[model samples]
Target: MVLQGALGVSLTFNCGDTDVAQEAVERSFAIASERGDPLDRLRLLGPMQMLYFRTGRFGTALHYARELAAVAEELGDADAATLARTFKGVSFHLRGDLRSAREELEGALSGRPPKEVASYLGFEHFLAAIFLARTFWLMGDTDLALEQTADVVSSSEESGHPLSHVITLMWAVTVFLWQGDIEAAENHIDRLETRAAAHGLQAYLAVADGFRGEVAVRRGDAAGGAQRIRAALKELHAARYELLTTPLNVTLAEALCAIGHHAEALEEVRAAINLVETNGDLVYMPDLLRTRGRIEAAMGPRKRDTAEATIHEAVTLSRRQ
Candidate 1:
């Protein structure tokens, strides 16, 4: 019963039903840990790690990941151990520790054959490679980043899991968008929406809408894109889905600036960076800071000093990572 309840809580939390999920998370964890077997304890730990990671609690997420790793090792479960390593890699990526993130993610994908990864990385073939691609891109390895991204898309399409395919495209669109390849990103966004709608994954469909707005912004429809992105952002946050908000905000800020809303754009980026810092999740900081600097620079000579400072900071941080 306790195990079932914990599972229920995790599902609720993962599904964006945060009102009840938040209140029940710790209590469910407590009960399961005290009365459940080690395997059952392991069950809750995986979801708990995912929960914290989703909520941008990278430090706490890493802590849970460590616990999960220890328990998985105790059980002699190689697959679970691999999963922990993947999450640790993702957490490190989010924390802006690119070298460490690269180490763990590569380690997770290193030893296993391609056939084993589908099961090893979980049926959805989540985020390890997806995040790794971004890490490489941020580290200024565009060729390798694009290469890894293509590999991810190919592997995901062949994963035999529809949800996995959707997740891959959902996250992979960023690379093309970052490369200023709106056409490619739009193609993936179309696929993302189709898959999301087919699977009734409403949250992802919502995310798809935001991505479309991003495409629009890139194509010069600043005002319309800003409005569309804002609506989607409202919907996602209402659903307690935060993973893509940072990037979308960066796009939204750019859109706002193009349309002569520099002050609003600055405010938006500031709030976004503050949230990133407060959460100890630096995954999006360099980009957000760069966007902030761009906004200030566009405001003309009055903000030049601060704009230079902001850009300098962003460059330093981006290089460090």
Candidate 2:
């Protein structure tokens, strides 16, 4: 069953049959809980947590992360404990608890160097740092956010772990994109595509493709970028990947807005926010709202008041964080 759990992760990342992959991971986790050794449970928990987290089941992911932390503590596995802490912090950030996320992630990285943090399941200190940076960005610590993101890339490169590399590049795109660092985003996207293809990391490759499309939108190829992003989004959705879905949707909204499809763009941002609310993944709400506001403002002077209110709401939300 433990081997079966590993197979589930392979299927999840390498193959596209996500329903079957989820089944395998869930079944193996159940079995591990019932009868497997303590170590087996720890092993299964990591993958299980990842499956739920990426699928937008933040509550369940948090539950599993806490369990993982407890199991690691009981076993006196410091590495696993650090990884679990990172996972917990990530889930918290996704759930819009920026302060808690910051504390947990910082604590995970504080006691030891990230180099000493071992990769467990799909998480490492790089993963933790990724969210921590995003958390800082969301909480208005722009400098710290950029700093953490830079550290993530440098540390991941130094570690020489392919998974770490992909993870860092794949996610760091968010900070860069949000900051309007198109050149940096494009460069990272190119590297991400190359590395993901080389490693046969199809999922990250899919993400890279979508991000590339986002750059295309900025490059005055809104229609082409929209098409590319829609296609990539379809593949990722079918694979049950939701963590990046909102960001992709935000880019798609931008593409639509650029093309004068204000109505459609507004719809896209609204849908993205709805998804965030439904899944308790509120990390992207303010951005989604901001995008929606921009789309509304583009509609006409008739919507100016609505646009201002919406944008104001976004500012208020961000400030509250």
Candidate 3:
């Protein structure tokens, strides 16, 4: 019963029904707690952390990470402990503590918990690898980041799990995009779209659409790309999936700026900044600020001071990280 409830939460979350997902998680946790089974509680903790993380509630996610660790230790579950560490690493990354994030993620990945552990933890190691790759990129190890990303994507594809394939492919798309490999990005997006569709994973589909739109813009279809991105953003907002909002908004702003739509670009940038500020999503703050600076500069001399200030803030944050 508790396991079914946990699965229910995961399914609803993938379908973008956040409220139902949270309710299901709460019910599952309640059941697990009542049963007084440490393993059951540990299992429920993973989804609870994920639910909060997906909603940009990093602190709450971290709280669950702590609980997960405690329960995993009580049960002597090394696999669960590894998964809990991964969650903590990701939460740390989101909170802008890059060094600690690197340490935790490295520890999790180094141990290479068995495949059964990955299955039991719902393949969270894939997510950990993705976050680790991102951290590597942010820390100026782009080559290693790309290598790690490729490894994760390849492994995920070989795993033959639609959920894992879609999630890993989505991050792989981001890596390709950052590398300026538009063709590679599009290819991964295609795979992600197919897998997400097969699984009825609406949230991943929306994310793919957003990435596809970004690729289109980069490929020189600025107007068309901007329209597609706008549509995807609408879908994401409707679904209350704010996980990718900052990056998508940045992409949209870049597309608009490319098309000489500085005013609209500025608006998008501001919206992204507001989102991160309100959600406490510092993971993308530096990028958001950088985009804001670019838009402000494109708005002309009237906003030059604002542009400098915005860019300076980004630089300061980057250095601190």
**In terms of TM-score, which candidate is strongest?**
3
Candidate 3 Cα errors over 4 Å, as ranges: 13-16, 116-118
lDDT of 3: 0.83
lDDT tens per residue, model 2, 1-321: 867787788887774587878899988878877895788888888888878876778888889889988998988988878877888898888877788899989888888765556666544677888888888877778899889888888888777788888889888998888778999898888888888898787878878889888889888999999999999999787767777898889989989999998888888888888888888777778888888989999999999999999999999887765
Candidate 1 has its poorest 10 consecutive residues by lDDT at: 117-126
Error of 3 at 140 (Å): 0.8
Give me the candidate number with maximum lDDT. 2
Candidate 1 Cα RMSD after full superposition onto the native fold (Å): 2.5
Q: How many clashing residue pairs appear in each of the predictions shown?
A: 0, 0, 0
**lDDT scores in order:** 0.80, 0.84, 0.83
lDDT of 2: 0.84
